[model samples]
Target: MDTMRDRFAPVVSRLLDEDPRVAVVLAEIGKDGFAEAMRRHPERVINVGIREQLLVGAAAGLALTGLRPIVHTFASFLVERPFEQVKLDFGHQNTGAVLVSAAASFDWPAGGYTHMAPGDVALLDTLDGWTVHVPGHPDEAETLLRRAVAAGDDKVYVRLSVQANRQGRAVDGERFLTVREGRSGVVVAVGPVLDAVLAATEGLDLTVLYATTVRPFDTAGLRRAVQGADTDVVLVEPYLTGTSTAAVSEALAEVPHRVLGLGVGRRELRRYGTVEEHVAAHGLDARSLRERIGGFVGAGRASVRA
Candidate 1:
């Protein structure tokens, strides 16, 4: 049950160990874990104090200087505290730096609202050159990280949860993982909600798509996948509707699709609970998903009888 951080550490460790040109930037919160991983390859670790803005700016500077830099920090701090810096310094300049956003969404309920970043994905997607990825499981996280690092020039934002061992089928070659067949009437989900969707529709004909890469979406693949099945499509995510879900809907305009966005509403998060509680409260749980699917398919009576 390795967390996204755990999955990322070894891949990053190997990258640093193999390539001297790659540098790892650690924010105040993620420094310990990143530092521990980079200990065996000490020369590559760049510990930047508590300044999220400066951390990203420094990573941009390093990238400009031809060193590949991976900036790590909590999602809220990474997006909010240094938004302008990220937009202008990295996004504008098209720096090849990668941002590994840890504790995205409600992953750290103990950290409270300030630490909870429900809008990070929304903010990042507006940027022109940046590619945003929200991996549902550890395997997807690792694959996305590898792709981000290998891209070399495109700015990448990776939203990762603190939870461990999420279930997702690995994608072939790319970070864009797919579960079920690439059939029509696909239900696209990000984060652990994919597991809920899979469990909810155990024997159904619906295609479940695990969108590991959120921004810079796989449009061609998506189009091909949904071309042959039912016209109805659903998109499930753990962030606000305007972010990933909106983007997906806009892309699927040719088809009859409905996006079932699940996340904290427009209001700020004011509750106290674990990630599971927050997800369930917002109707992102397995039971809730089953209810939604039943309603969507108009098979409530059949599901109830079974």
Candidate 2:
């Protein structure tokens, strides 16, 4: 499968070159690939070393100056390192800066606990005036990025992973694609696990909601989706049980909701392994997810179906 870099490089490069008002801040590590793309455009790029704080601050400043800035960085550095800067500079001031957080969750293996961001969803959800999106595939990523760039809203964070399946381009306006539709229950998923959800519910009657937008959630659409469902909804994410789960619960207050968060638990780092290994260790793999869904289905039948 093509990497997220391969999928987004062309589109991002075009946007940088075409939009004179756009500026890109590439992380020190992301510089090689992103910089090469920007070099093609020449005058639309900026570098901020390895200082995540400075990167965010600069992007916030650029936004204030009427320039659209896209800040690229590792998910951990983006969320933990420059958190205060993001909160005060962008969140407080409401700057129209787009944050592209790569290697979200455990996508970057052997990076260890220091670089692992298993709580980004929870952290960003706490802040107001921020739109958080975690695209499940490359096509969704492109669409979401384009929409964020065109959107007037400030403080947008896109949590990206390197595992997107680049099968084909997303259909127009397919950002919020409905993987399944059912009047009984809803299962919302983000990140690479979307494919897992699809596979798990191959013959189930439950609705599967592919929510690309994590924060500033589509409350209206979500509420409508779960309006008549008999059983409580289930939210799946690549993080701990907090943001995505809590948001759905709050949004569908009248209706019940359950969250099945999958990520590295808060603890010391262990042995080194690949991204898939880490995800599997923490029950984030497709098979584990399928079992969880099976349990939910069984319970739902007992409570609602029967």
Candidate 3:
């Protein structure tokens, strides 16, 4: 599978070379991937060392100067650590930027709690008018990034995870794409969690929906899909659990529905080794998802064994 960062590097290089108004701000990360690109367009690329706050601030400044800025860094540093900068510098000032984040959730669990950012999406939800894209595959990432860059002055958050699904590209719209069809219920898989969700629901009578563009969420699409189904929706996100609960609730307000939010558990497990271990610890593995989802739709246990 092609890595998201690897896919991003070339697109950014192309953007820099083609558009003089495009600038990239990095914070001691992605230097290896963007080494040549940076060297080629030294004036357009800026690295602010380890200072995430200054990194975002500089990006905001660049945006103010009529240049589109793509701010790249780990999810922890880009969204969590320098949240104030993101909220005030960009959100408050109304400056637009493509906030590209890598190492989503517990991708680098060995890096510990400080490096994990399960709350990044929830935090971004607090700010208004931010388009959040959680691409499930590298191809989807490329498509989303290109669209975000083309939609200049729109504050977009492109969340990239190390994990990927079984290669599926998203459609050219802000709507959920139906991957599998069934009458039991609807399973909405966000970003890289598609493969896991697919495995979990294998052989089950359920509908699976995929979304790369999460924010500006496809509420209309969701409502249309759930129109004649069981109205049992299970949202599987890669970030904080229940991140889209409110949106789902609003979308299906008039219909009688039962929704189960699944993602990295709310509690900090505080123990980690491999990515799979962290995912299991958070009850995000295929088995756990199957059981929990089964319970939600009345196919298994009375309650999920989390």
Ranked candidates (TM-score, high to low)? 3, 2, 1
- Flag clash pairs in model 3: none
lDDT of 3 by residue, 40-91 (tens): 9898899999999999999999999999999999999999999999999998
Every model: Cα RMSD to truth: 3.8, 2.6, 2.8
Task: Report the Cα lDDT for candidate 2.
Answer: 0.73
The candidate with the higher TM-score, 2 or 3, is: 3
TM-score of every candidate relative to the true structure:
0.87, 0.89, 0.95
Error of 1 at 229 (Å): 2.7
lDDT of 1 by residue, 135-204 (tens): 7778878887888888866788888886533555665333344578633257777665677777876777
Q: Considering lDDT, where higher is better, how would the candidates rank from best to worst? A: 3, 1, 2
RMSD of 2: 2.6
Best by TM-score: 3
Write candidate 2's Cα lDDT for 1-306 as tens digits: 665655655677788878877788866866766666656756667777878889888888888888898888888998888889988998788676888887787776677777778888777766787777777677778887888887774677777788664343352322345768876577877666777777777777788877677666767777777767755576767776545666676777876565454444675447769887877777667788778777876686686646
**Candidates' lDDT values, in order?**
0.74, 0.73, 0.89
